[model samples]
Target: MSVLLEVQGVTKTFGGVVANQSVSIEVRAGEIAGLIGPNGSGKTTLFNSIVGAHAIDEGSIKFEGEEISTFRVPVIARKGMLRTFQQTRIYGEMTALENMRISAPEARVSALSLLGGFSSKTDTRGEELLEFVGLASKRFLRAGALSFGQQKLLEFAMALMSEPKLLLLDEPTAGINPTLINGLIDRLKQANKELGVTLLVIEHNMRVIMNLAERITCLAHGEVLASGTPDEVRNDPRVVDAYLGAG
Candidate 1:
């Protein structure tokens, strides 16, 4: 498989607090890699640094063999690297179709032109995308009117609008019901299989991460405790010490 993302000696510090300490990892094309750690292990901070939300005090980040440590968030996103937030950010007043249309880069012109109303083409694409996330029946409803799981699905669909090659998802299945969580996993798997999009997920749910990630990276106090296949990492003594305890 082709390498899509590389991080070398990445470190970020906030005065006395070290957020990420000499971290390094790579994500290959068409793979789902899960990152797990305790609450303050710097998983989110490292993600923020990668996406330009925070600057790296040291190290470099590369995408498709090109150095992108200095690029801004929009530049990185335009380069086919996208990051989704742990918290879903959708327009409450907008309909499900409208929400997808807003982030659809290719649909921008048609969407803006139909500011008065949605055109048939826009409606179709939006509806299709909604259907992709099992939200087709809710297309006409307001985004905020949907349940937490539906909103999460909408957020994923909106990210798809960017046509990303590498997707950074922070806690994608968090705050959702168990039934809907499985659906989210299946959708992500389908995206990876059909679209060949690479995924790097930061999820706390052990079972979810284990089932989805081909390789799992465990972080502890801003350091890598273990990195391996789900089975290996799950049985790792250090990883267990860091996150799971003897049981």
Candidate 2:
């Protein structure tokens, strides 16, 4: 698989504190990769830097071998990448279908375009994705009425509306009931295998990441500590020590 995203020697700081220090990692095309670490390990900071949420203090970020370190979020998103927050971001007042329609890049082309109409094709696709995420029955329901887990599913479908080539998900399984986790995992796998969307997932759930990701990268103190396949990362003494010591 070719490298889809690369972060080399990336660094970011706020005032005197360094949130990320020369951190580097890679995600390949057509694969689900996991980012794991204890709290304050700069996992989300790395994602923010890569997605142009903030300016990096140093190093480079490349998407499909093109330098995008200086690009802003909208530009990067237009290049077929987007991210979902740990807290679901949905329009509480809008129906799930309405949220999906507004999420398309075309709908966001301009402030005026938002008031303009959407095509039937977009509506059809929205329903398809809603069904894909098991929210078809709730398509017309207001987003705020859904449970937290359902809102996350709706957010996932919203991100898909843009047909992004790569999706960065931050702690996707957090704050969900254990019973629903398996179904969510299945949907994630389906999205990767059927929709051909590559995923870079930040997950604190050890078993979930171990089962979902093809490879895992672990961070410690804002730096790359270890990266490998699931078994390799799970058995690595450094990873064990980091988690244990954090405890």
lDDT of each: 0.86, 0.93
Candidate 2 minimal-lDDT segment of 10 residues: 107-116
Stretches of candidate 1 off by over 4 Å are: 107-122, 245-247
In Å, residue 223's CA in model 1 sits off its true spot by: 0.9
Model 1 global lDDT (CA atoms, 0 to 1): 0.86
How many collisions between residues are there in candidate 2? 0
- List of clashing residue pairs for candidate 2: none
Off by over 4 Å in 2: 110-116
> What tens-digit string does per-residue lDDT give for candidate 2 at 1-247?
9999999999999898888999889999999999999999999999999999999999999999999999999989989999999878889999999999888778756777678677899999999999988899999999999999999989999998888999999988898899899999998999999889999999999999999999999998888889999999999999999999944
Kindly list the per-residue Cα lDDT of model 1 for residues 59-169, writing each as its tens digit: 999999999988888878878888888888788899888888767655444535555654576567677778999999998899999998789889898888667899999
